[model samples]
Target chain A: MRRWLALILVFTFALVAPGTNPRAGEGQAAPEFTLRDIDNKPVSLKDMTGKVTLISFWATWCAPCQVEMPHLQKLYDTYKDKGFMLLMISADDARSVSRVKPLIKSKGYSFPVLLDTDTKVVSQYNPNKTLPYSELIGPDLKVLWQHQGYTAGDEVETERRVKAALDALAAATPPAVAPTATP
Target chain B: MPPTPRAALVTAAQALLLGLGVFSSGLAAAGEGEERPEVSVSGQDDLEFRYWRDDRTLPDFPEEDHLFDYWELVNRVNVKLDRGPLQLGVQLDAVGMLGAYYYLNDVRVDEFDLHADGVTFPLPLAYANLDKAWLGYQGDSAQLLVGDGYIAFGRGLALSLVKNTNIDIDSSLRGAHAKVTLGAWDLTAVSGVTNAQQVWQDNPNKQQIRPDHWHMVSGLRIDRYGLGPLNLGAHSVVYSFADRADLDAQPWEGYGRGVDAAITGASVEAFGVAGLDLFAEGDLFLYPGGEVLGVEDNQPGYAVYGSAAAYPGRVALLVEGKHYKDVERVNAVVSRDLYEVAVGPTLEYERVITEDSGAAVNSNDISGVRLRADVAAKPGVLTPSLTLGLFRDRELGGLHFNRAPETIVHPIAGVDWIADSVHVLANAGFRVDKRDDLPGGVSLGADRMAHVDLSLGFPIGSAHGEIGGDLRYFMWGDNLNQQTDFTLLTANAAVHLGHGVSIVGYTDWTDDPLIDSVGNINENLYAAGELQLQPADGMTFKLFYGAYRAGIRCAGGQCRMLPGFDGARLSATINF
Candidate 1:
């Protein structure tokens, strides 16, 4: 009887043991990293403090990512003035900067093209190594939500999530406290 | 306790029951309230039957001695919930198939089992979303999640989801992630592993096959800046995977990196001139070992894809061009390879035809220039659109793999009777190939085929009834200096009684010149009917029957290798 009970316990543990990552949900601080864009300018995660941020990781070869580029432009237009900023990063080879740079010019995307030629940044956050992933972070640098895979109808979800995060932030900020006159 | 098979059976049975019990428990919350406790279930099923008989028994193609039968059934279930800041979900699907038309044997179907936490099914299939689920926490400004999910930055030219469902594959990430947003910039970092599932397995021991694990890490940062009528944006996605000796039989170190950028702008009306739109984007991938993990490499594997559809009142011209190269690189990463190059331009002219009767139709005349090269590198086809109403699709390439060039010439034409809901369509085309270079026993020299089809559909009673008929004639001329011809007629009726109830029935008949040596007229007739009922939100029950008059049966691009079959089919999908 004891042996059978022990076996059952072991099986149960196996079913529940796999998931163990720790970088999402509420109250969690984002991981720190610094990298350079395609133009060779250094960029850091800490630089965008105190503002809402939309961080996206993608590669040029992804078809759906290509389709969603113009839609991202729409979101940028609607919320940029409301403290919404986006960080775009790539893990392309440093040698093909010429190829990548010219192609970027042709597509007409309005986002900066940072480079992680060594892939140091890629390994820091995206473990599966798949491309075209996005994470939405609030003004306080907390990751509000993240999603993977781009289908025909994903733009709606992306817009809804971004707007929700922005609204929540807007609601939390207290109106400017007015100075009281001395009696 | 000497490890008897019965005990193992009992233990396995207990686990199975436990899982099913949990699944039913989740289904117990189906009423429109508080969101069903975060559990979701979905599924699909199909069944088919065919029958065939030959007038003359030829040596090469002998008639079947008995009737053939085929049927299939499948079911999928999922359950998800949250634990404090952590989330979890489990999914399972079982498939059962049976057919004796091709070879006499037992049913063989694949089994799938998936599990995750803190994540939801992405798009497409909500049951497949295992992207993120792990121990994590979130505050007002920053948050972290660990497990499986996807990330993207800029245009995902060099990196993106490797989603191709036709062959059935979904790339998933298993790892840890961190994100922080401030002002106009967002920063995120993640690390994990993939290829944790064995690519192939036999049914006897398929469950034991575990995915191969590889360590990977990546980070991204994006900042948007712009001016009036002009915007300049930049983003980068960087990732690296630790080399695993087991990844490949050969010894080699592996790592990957990529970057994408864009600049977009448009003119304002202030100048009284129509705004001139301008934009550009690109991506570069750098991974020595990317090929092993399904990442394309070299030749930039790049694309400069864009389109312009400026609107000026009732007229619009849209033009788009995309250039993809190093097509083999994608194949190098994964085992499958499909490459294509195409450029399409469309001119749409739309003017309100009539406004009184709610009748408005826009006409679209499009032409496409496409070049497709399959694995054989032969039959490099060039297809072009022709005619204002019917788009003529022709294949201008040699044959490969003893297979005829697909869609020698297909014309797409349709006229709407009552706007978009009711329509009539007619298409006629000719396809011929004189390719003398074909495998013996499969050559069709001097062969030509022409076909015409007309179909019409409209609402019958209320908003659910639909009636349609299709008539098609195929004429094969001068094949090996011989003539072969055939004609087919079909009629269909469908009624949708709302409330998830539908009934559909169709009958088809065909006549053709026989190819058998004995020489006899080839005749085929079939009738199929199906009644579908969905009493609840998550359940579908179908009762179908089919009868065929000794002829070949093929439909929906799927052809059974077995002989013709005749039988009844029943399928169902239940949530609880």
Candidate 2:
């Protein structure tokens, strides 16, 4: 019995040791990926570098995700002109991809919806692959915040984080130079 | 003053209205750019009335007949408040029954007796209680929560506290929980008291109500991520039972102090590895000296589970295996109800060996393997799949497999099709169980089982609605080589009549050969029609009349038998 216990301890230590910083942790650079939107148009994360980006990984079968979508849309509409963007990435696989378009259309949402058919992009952002996962990336491509799961009224905190990031970005940008007469 | 169900319902409604008023007023008072606490309210109420014809006597109470007419109303309310980093939530449930149901009335004699200290209500019915109330704080890197809540770890293999209303089970722990993330490590800890069971006893002289004893539970888990694509985790849980000699005198006593137990496990999972994902976990259970059927001894057990899946191109394949030995020890300390207690991991496969069959895992002497493959025949249009499973179980105390081992093999094939407005799904499966080296004269259980299910749904373009139908058949070959079969057919249709009004109708028919006795066929039919109105956003009301039949309802590997009836149902829901 003692031997078994020792063996298990060794195994756990071996797995836990030797791990470097995670790629998706706060202050780490967000990975870049290109995926197709609901209309089959390519969307790349690198293109949105000058603005604060909020990427949410969700699925149609997740109840909490469904509840959070409307709030996300509201946030997007409220801050779209203030250098903020929200992208809802659907992790529906090939088997259930057919249900995504109809659901989005039925809900009358104007936010851009992307399909992660193979779940390749979501895995880069969320190693655990938890549903309704949200990550906020600053204008500098560094992850500002990350959250797993959702509950009613969680939108408040999420909105606060997004606004704070946007405010910081605005404060960092230099003012525009005065226009000069034509030479 | 004491309040009845009717008065309670009125009070609840008034309180909700008052809350809404306050929320609105608060929102109005907040000036532009001012921070205000966010409040949200959501709830649903279901009222159903049933009438019985050709009433039969209940098996338990042979002297009395089943209720000829009855009505029940179930209401659930949830309120959430959030401001900055602090959060508060409350959820309440109330159930009221009125009818000729004597048994149900007797059960309500002491409904208000067992409540958490410092919590009180005007109406304390058998079905009314404060389901959940919690206060929590969310930080950038940590979270602290207290009061009633749900918790789970690593696919719930070792510990899971959840609530399933469909099965009338709520295992939410009343406790304190904390989660923190430090660099590459994530830590979680929980300490709580399990919810007590509500048992009702009916006697001629006096009605008796006893609450199931509660136990202490604590657990800790640590997880490390960023090992490329691999993440590892370790978890341990301890259940402590209080010494209660009084419980020994009861006819149905729960786990006592003598049967304290602990579970420890470790898991490793890897994802995004060349389109392959893998996970494996091993759990060890330790039980101090305990008496099993009057025999006392300490028996330790262990279990191992692993699964691998790969989605390469259009084809998806998965393989899983599990082996358990003498690991089925009672662990009610972490569960709200005794029936919902489970200490073993559940392995889910297709039909024959379903996940809902936790009994298969509780045997403590079983091993199983399952393999499945799915191919996208036409991309998103059609998909077909095939599955195979094998399970083996050895005798109670035998180390060798030759001692009356039971083996089962199951194979299944299925297909799913989806188009612009049409969807269809079907599956067929067969199971064969073989036994070897039977004891002197013991009989075999089920030898063979087969089943088929088909469902089709489509939109009625002209009517602006949808219609669907389902057909299912199942056959069981019992020990005596006798065959029993069940057939079910159902059809439903709905239509929108504009102005936020809709009409829906459904009918179900069942034919079972084993409902009563051998060779006695029982056929039942149920029909229902409903009208739904959604006059505005966040509000809906539905009224329906139906004739229903009793049947088994299952969800999330849990099953419950619900009594059927013929009656009307009214429901309303609002979210804001």
lDDT of 2 at B425: 62
Interface RMSD, in order shown: 16.0, 18.6
Number of residue pairs clashing in candidate 2, backbone atoms closer than 3 angstroms, sequence gap of 3 or more or interchain: 0
Per-residue CA lDDT of model 1 for B1-576, tens digit only, reads: 123335434654564466445444634545666454332221111111112222323244336633222233233233333322223333333322233123324543222222122112221111211122233333334556544444433333433332221222324345566766564344556555443222211011112223233434344544442344333444444434333333431111223322211112111111112533333444333434454545434223343433333323322222333333322233232322111001111111111001100000100111222221111111111111122211211222221211222212222332212212343334444433333434565644433344444444345554355555555454442233243456556567777665556788867676644421111122366777889775542244677676433222211111111123235555543322
Whole-model lDDT values for every prediction: 0.39, 0.57
Under CAPRI classification, how is model 2 graded?
Answer: incorrect
What is each candidate's DockQ, to 2 decimals? 0.03, 0.03
Task: Put down candidate 2 lDDT per residue, B406-480, tens digits, no spaces.
Answer: 687778887766554455666777776666545676545545556665555454553345455555565543333
**Model 1 stretches with alpha carbons more than 4 Å out:** A1-183, B1-73, B82-87, B96-145, B148-156, B162-171, B176-181, B186-280, B285-300, B332-457, B467-492, B506-527, B544-576
Candidate 1, residue A147: CA error in Å? 24
